[model samples]
Target: MGGVVERTDLGRGDDPLIGRVLDGRYEVGQKIARGGMATVYQARDLRLDRTVAVKVMHSGLADDPEFVSRFEREARSAARLSHHNVVSVFDQGDDRGTLFLVMEYVPGLTLRDLIRKDAPMDPGKALELIEPVLAALAAAHGAGMIHRDVKPENVLLADDGRIKVADFGLARAVNAETQHTATGGVLIGTVSYLSPELVVDGKADARSDVYAVGVLLYEMLTGVKPHQADSPIQVAYKHVHEDVPAPSLREPALPAYVDALVARATARDRDLRPSDARVLLHQVRRVRQALDHGVVEDPELYADLMPGVRPIAEDTGEVTGELEREDRISILGADDVYDQDREVTTAMPPSGVATAVPPRPPQNLAHNQPPRVVPPPVVADEPRRFQQPKRSRRGLFLLIGVLVTALLVGISAWQLGRYTTTPSVISLSQSAAKAKITKAGLTFKLGKAEYSEKYTKGSVMDTDPAPGDKVSKGGTVTVILSLGPERHAVPTVRGKTLEEVQQLIADADLSLGEVTQAYSDLVDEGMVVTTDPKAGTLLKRDTAIDVVVSKGPKPIDITDWTGKSAKQAQKSLEKQGFKVTVDEQFDDTITKGKVISQTPNTGQGVKGDEITLVVSKGPELFAIPHVRGLRTNDARQKLEDAGFKVKVHHSSLFVGANYVVTVSPGEGTMVPKGTTVTINVV
Candidate 1:
């Protein structure tokens, strides 16, 4: 796949491996791009006679055996995928000390470059670009792999207008053991594309990739990330706690269904999102269909795409009943009592007013024991039933009395058993505390946790009811967990830049307490030398992280030392921390053993800088050559070739004779280069 070239300090020719062959198969060519993990170079597959791209890992990472193994494994896994939208991985091998991967070389720019040039793309175009990316992810996910780092830079746009995805399983491999941080402690994936679950718990699955794609779609349609903040931490927090605003909020021209699609895919709760890339791909197609149909308001489609609203559980009905009972008890005054006898009497008919009662004669005399009685008459065709009716009414009244007594008793029993004292769960682990609460027939709730030195992290520090406080059965018991000691480990920041050190301090929840400067030969200037407490020291949060920075190698100024003895000059330069190399030569003017010249005659250099000194070895000397029998031209040519400045001298009378009498410095002599030689011709 053609990846977007990330801007970096390195140029195309910066990599030393360029133009070198790896494994005697792939010949590395010009660098195509450089990223945090590796440098991509255009290469030639010599055996296959085809062009390929070779990605060479950085030395620092390749040195780690674990990381290298993981990298190789992931490369193999990615190679197994045969989707057309995926960049093909052909080979992986280590050459000498360098580890590299040979992949298909696509000829084009990256999605990142496209976004920079033409963004806020039309809805149709945005969907078109995202569809293929989803398909590639779908294939990877189907193989039980995840592209943890999904961003525009990994999405490639080929010259032929084909879209492809790169670096399929690399992020997962890197992030396997721990949260992978690139140089300067920035996360491996782009912060803008990080999912909420990844930010909060450092966990990711297929849904996390879906969330990233949703963010991608939003950026493509709106020209900006859905969540924006001053720092990555803040942006990550927003992703955890806030829902991504609809795209229409930024670009009102976007249809509502598009916003709904983004929302569903990026929902903070993984359960509410599409389960995997395939499901999200299906949703993408539906949205595309809506856009193609030119539907203005597709509420039905929007609803279908929206996350399912969770329904209240049936167990909540018990809670509602308890609440209602409590409300009724509070409303009813305890002092209020009813007069049962008066109530019964008020409900019954008056004896004197009732004409249906049986007729009777009262006794006249107090002393008389006998009394006269009379029976009631019935209506026509009906037997006398006055006494029976009265009996029936009396039976009904008794039944009502028993029912009222039973209702009062049941209410009293419920009130008596309604509440119980909460049990102590302090200093217990979260799971144990939850089990205890559940055993007590009460619900458990996790409340805000605070740092406590007395309790370990993830343990219950306190409860709402405080132990032994009255609480109803099935009542919620909110417990505050301890975050443990409020301490953070000092992170390794040596060799990092000042800004990077500051970021590391902040990420560790520590303050940039103080910055000191010092000269370091090993560390580059403006980079960190060491921290006060060093790395991996545990201390309270916000603890000052004093850093010592490098001022680079010490600078020294060179002084003029012409005519000085070579040995003395070498000693003087060496004492001043300069590396000196002396060269002996025959000088015409300077005395023997005296310094003739020095490279970088007058300049300032750092300690340990190399300085070359040229020492004199006296004037050149040679025996005169016997050229009496030789031709004059031959003698002159031989003299000139033997490290000499030749000067031919003709005798006054023998100007035309082609014979030489003698030559100066011509035989059996060692002379300095360019020494003067005189030849006499006769």
Candidate 2:
């Protein structure tokens, strides 16, 4: 959308119906162009909300019932065609005697405009423009609809560089009943581009369209029509009596093969031209490839493009015969004529030639004058000459007969040996392969089918004699088909043991690859956790499948702590993967900082095992306040008995006084039994 620009008009202001809307759906905006039978307008499809080109038939033609019926029929036929290079016909309707066709509106100049702007284009560019047009015509021809009119004006070159052919069946409708003018009568096709058959008899077919394209291509490459005249009748006469000259004559630098292409397509004898636009399309592609490869002369390709010798005077015409014979010499060498059945002929006379006429009136002077004397006929006598003996003549005839018979036999044998070969049907479906084989004069039989990695099921894989191998005409060829890829699905072996999984893999046409062990919560030990390329995975036959087995949950070891610090012991046990719990207890022998005992102190346990540790609280203590009033020795003995040490301090003035007058001011207190007690005496 960012790069696209919407076009609202076709830049024409002379049309009267520029702003008119028809059928209550199309909002006609501007006039694109006017043709012989219709005037195209840029219009919007209000119902579909899209831009389209509306081709409205001339009011006079629309008023005719026969023309309208044919128009509608041809419109439907064109609508049935679906191709990338064709302009799509969307809808057809009539509003108040105005017949119109809604078609895709391409936003670019027509090929006619391109030719006018860039005449004498290079051969490569000329082929590029014509290829898509041929493709469009090929689609129509394949669908049994002939594009009676194929010219540059009908070929649309879109802004995106896409070439599309427009007016698929319009030409047939316009030329259906052969409109005649008050002046000299002529056909509806463009004069300069009309085919010889069309101009002569007003009859057209796919080959006629091919002829038009050929003329168009010639004009593109030479900037002029192959035949030109002031009047349409005269131009039509040349088309019938003369052959289209090669493009190289006008553009002398053009390749000879290019000339051959033009000559083959525009041959005055329709039989000599491509049978249809599809065949012409193939020839065009081959010529384009040759040009791209810079091939200046390709006699082999030229012979193929224009097969067989040019038609003689008996086949086409003296004028055409002479030109074809000369063209073939330059196009394909004189010695390179490929022999083929000559089945086509141009027998019709030029149009407006007045084939039917009334008898002329008798002369009135013959009755008034006396009859003149008639002369008697006379005969001349001739002399006879003696001939050879009958026996000698018979002997000469017999020898000639034997020589002709031998020549026929030898030619037939060579043809059978050289032209017959097994056609390639590999990768084709069975029905398609059979059709090809039968068409090639060969019998086909279905042979054994085997699994293949490349071809689809039921498609031909190989042949008995192989494709391109020499075979006799009507020889039998056996075909082998594919059964599709050979693949096996991995079997489910989640709960199966290693040995059982291996056996299952083998049963599934697979090999046991790598076996790995891993701890799994769901699967038990020695059981498969899962198989690589898991269950139901399609793989090639005998593909290795990895397996993972389960090991039981891992075990952890507990550390002993009979004499280690309780806090340090709890940290050490937890680090070893055990849950630790501490309990306080009074122990007189064991140190207070040491762990007295532990639960599950030394054993193997899984992760998350609890280990309880009991720590020592030291000896019990009692109040020593009453010991301060007694002597130092007595207090010492009391404190020591209570698991405490006692000391006496003497004052300097009362050194001899060891009384308890001033004992180190002590009161009733509870402490660890190992605490020391001191007393003062004065």
Candidate 3:
């Protein structure tokens, strides 16, 4: 109910539908069953003109990339299952955000329905119903698939009275990555039919399934389940502690053979039950055959069914009296040996014919009775009876002596046989005892551990023989398993410097081993860094682990050489591992010969890094030009155009005319871009 509850997207306009039609060929119908991860629907395949069952996953999970991937993988896995008892998976698809599977639609009532009717079914018929189920389980389990949930609801009884196991939805493939169900919780199966192992440890095996089937068989015969506690937990506890009662004890009319089979299947010890589904299947067939042919009575089966009731005695040649003879060869036919309520009697003449005999006359009896006809004198009754009673006492004593002697001889022989019983020596190493046990034709069972502080981890803790107790050949000796050593959580060593982490490890009684480094933008430079084993992981004492430390980024420095030759600058810095940049220029005061100002200014930190510089070459100069024309200032402007700044002057030599002549610093002289010149009129 907590999984996929609604079918809004899967439903039609008014009708509820969940899956899409495949190849434009099949139209999936409404949802028929819903599970924690997927929903099943009945569909019609148009191309084949047949009906099919479609299992559509919940929309929420269908959208999950991981779930869809696993769904497709499981579909393929289910397809590989070709057993007749297993339902066939025909197709699978991921359409848009929906995932679904097309399967065979089995039309029939589930085993749950038949069980709920609460009527006694023929024991033989019940066996017949379970036989094929066991067969299916055998094949499925043999192929490494475990039907985690084996319950009445999952077993379909077809109209033709054939059984087909359905819903491998919870089944898991062994030795595969899909062993765990999608939902990660304690993997206990359905409560009512859950095995004891499923209850206690949440681990299931073939024996666990055997236990569930046993419960089913019990229910079939008695019309009642074995343990009926208010809750599943309580019932599970009873299964662990209480030995299951035979079905015949609860319903006396049921055959004892059924009880024996159920008891074996439901044995609490996993090893005591059938090893796997195959063995269980064989047993089921055997028992089914016996039941079908009316060969169901078992000689040793009565112990559990009728514990205190003495079985009807078998005939022996020793019985001599008329009543003994009548019982030995029961007067009735063998068919009448057992009556529904009481033992029936039928007259059988000595000749084996059903004939009656007439009574004889007294006169005929007197004719040859005795040779003496004389009558003895009658004495008072007490005196004669007392003497006769003493004779009877003597005869009784003789019989008692004979019985005691026979019993003593029988007991002596039994004691001699018991002396040959081998002692059960356990808790010694497995190999040490294996030889001796095998020699004696005995087996051993291993038990859970009982911790010991004195003995070493795997040393002998205790034994069943207690050093000298005797046991018979083939007797089981259980050795206790070891729990190894105690340990504590390794302290958090992350974020600490390498020295500090090592010191912490030493303090915790552990040792530092290999050290590896990795880039971490978060951690600081040159600090003790994190460890690979992580911190706070519980490990055994003296365990060695690897640690990692950080190394800061490499450093680079800035350098300068201002007035040096560009070539000289390159040579000076190259020697110090620094790159240089240079540019030439003219200076007013500094000569073209030497270096001027240096950067990374003197006495500053010289990291021999990159350097940029400016150099001086020579002084600034200008050129002069000649111009003689009216308006002397205008004449100076024309002279300045020839490479010198304007220097205008008035001319006194000519009347009403002012002109300019040659100037000093002649024209065409190399000069600085901005220089001025003076011109005077003469």
Scored by lDDT, the top model is 1
Clashing residue pairs in all predictions, respectively, total: 0, 0, 8
lDDT of 3 at 11: 45
lDDT (Cα, tens digit) per residue for candidate 1, span 406-443: 99899978876997768889778999999999999999
Task: Write the residue-wise lDDT of candidate 3 on 1-682 in tens digits.
Answer: 1122222234444534534565465687776655454566778866446687777665765664434434444555565566677766666665555566777777776676687675356778778778877887787778776666676666777777668876554334211222233222233244445665664455677788778787778877777767666433344445653445677776777666677677778776676677777887777776776666777576654343222322222332231111212331222111332221111111111211121111111211111122223356897666433444334587788899999999989998887676444444334565665566567666666666544322346644444433233456567666654454434456686577888888888787565657877644456665756764678876544445678776533344434455445567667676665555555567766667444555543443333455655566656654444454335667666656655566554445545445445443454555654466555555
Residue lDDT tens for model 2, 1-682: 0001122344755766777778788898877765456677888867546688888877877896546655766776787687889998867777888888888889988776787789999999999889889998899999999877666767788999999988888777766533422233334555566787786667788999899899899989998777765334445566766667767777989887788888889887788789998899989999999999999899988777653453222221122212211211111111133211110111123244443111211212111122233456786886887977665588888999999999999998888776587888988999999999999999989998866554689998777665765677888999889888767899999988888998899898776777889876577788899987789999755556888999854566777888888888988778766788889888878888789998987768765778889998776666766764566677667767877677777766566656665544365777666777677765
| TM-score head-to-head 1 vs 3, winner | 1
Query: Worst lDDT window (10 residues) for model 2?
Result: 339-348
Question: After superposing candidate 1, which stretches have Cα over 4 Å from the reference?
Answer: 1-10, 179-187, 308-682
Local lDDT at 515 for model 3: 80
lDDT by candidate, in order shown: 0.72, 0.71, 0.56
| Rank by lDDT (best first) | 1, 2, 3
lDDT of 2: 0.71
Model 3 TM-score is 0.40
